[model samples]
Target: MHAMTLRLSPGDDLRAALDHAFRTHALSAAYVLQGIGSLSVARLRYAGRDDAAELRGDIEILTLAGTLSAQGPHLHMSIADADGRVVGGHVAPGCIVRTTAELVIAHLPGERYTREHDAATGFAELVIRAS
Candidate 1:
């Protein structure tokens, strides 16, 4: 396994940065080890919602973790607003950084990963390849 650290700058889209890493590194399988930072805008899809809710403000990222693949990342994040109200959900695109975002990703060289629609879950879920 190998690891990488990324620092996102102001105006950088959170999801886009991570997606670029997945493609640029050619990671067959990877996971978001940790993520911390701040954002000016957060696009999050609440539970059982098809669309995302946009929260605009100075938000501090509390938690960010999930699986990553070439197909896309199934990431979840929690952020605290300026008033200290916490909100979190499935991370979507258009999450713009206000200051910086520091992230750690673990790359698994021996594993192959993919996402496929599952009838049971009604969502495209992770499929782990055998080592």
Candidate 2:
């Protein structure tokens, strides 16, 4: 497995940047080791809810870790608002950066991964294709 470090600048979309990096590196399987940064606009899908919630304000990214595939990323994150209130859920696209975000992604070669819609769960769950 190979590793990569990414620093997102202001105005950069958090999820978009990661997606671009994975595509640029042609990574079939990867995991975001750590992500620390801040965001101005956050898009998170709160758990137990079908729709996503938008958190707009200065927020600090607390925890970020998940899987990345050609289909998309299954990332979860927790962010703190101005008052230090923490909100966390499934990460969605459109999380724009406010200042800078430092992230490390580990690429797993010699294997492949994919996501397919599962009838039972009604979601595109992780479907490992290789060991």
Q: Model 1: per-residue lDDT, tens digit, 1-131?
A: 89999999999999989999999988899999999999999999999899999999899999999998878888999999999999999999999999999999999999988999999998899999954
Question: Which residues of candidate 1, in runs, are more than 4 Å off?
Answer: none
Question: lDDT tens string, model 2, 1-131?
Answer: 89989999999988888888989998889999999999999999997998889999999999999999999788999999999999899999899999999999999887777999999999889987764
Candidates' RMSD to native: 0.9, 1.2
- In candidate 1, which residue pairs clash? none
| TM-score of every candidate relative to the true structure | 0.97, 0.95
All candidates' lDDT scores?
Answer: 0.94, 0.91
> How many pairs of residues in model 2 come into backbone collision?
0
Q: Please give the clash total of every predicted structure, in order.
A: 0, 0
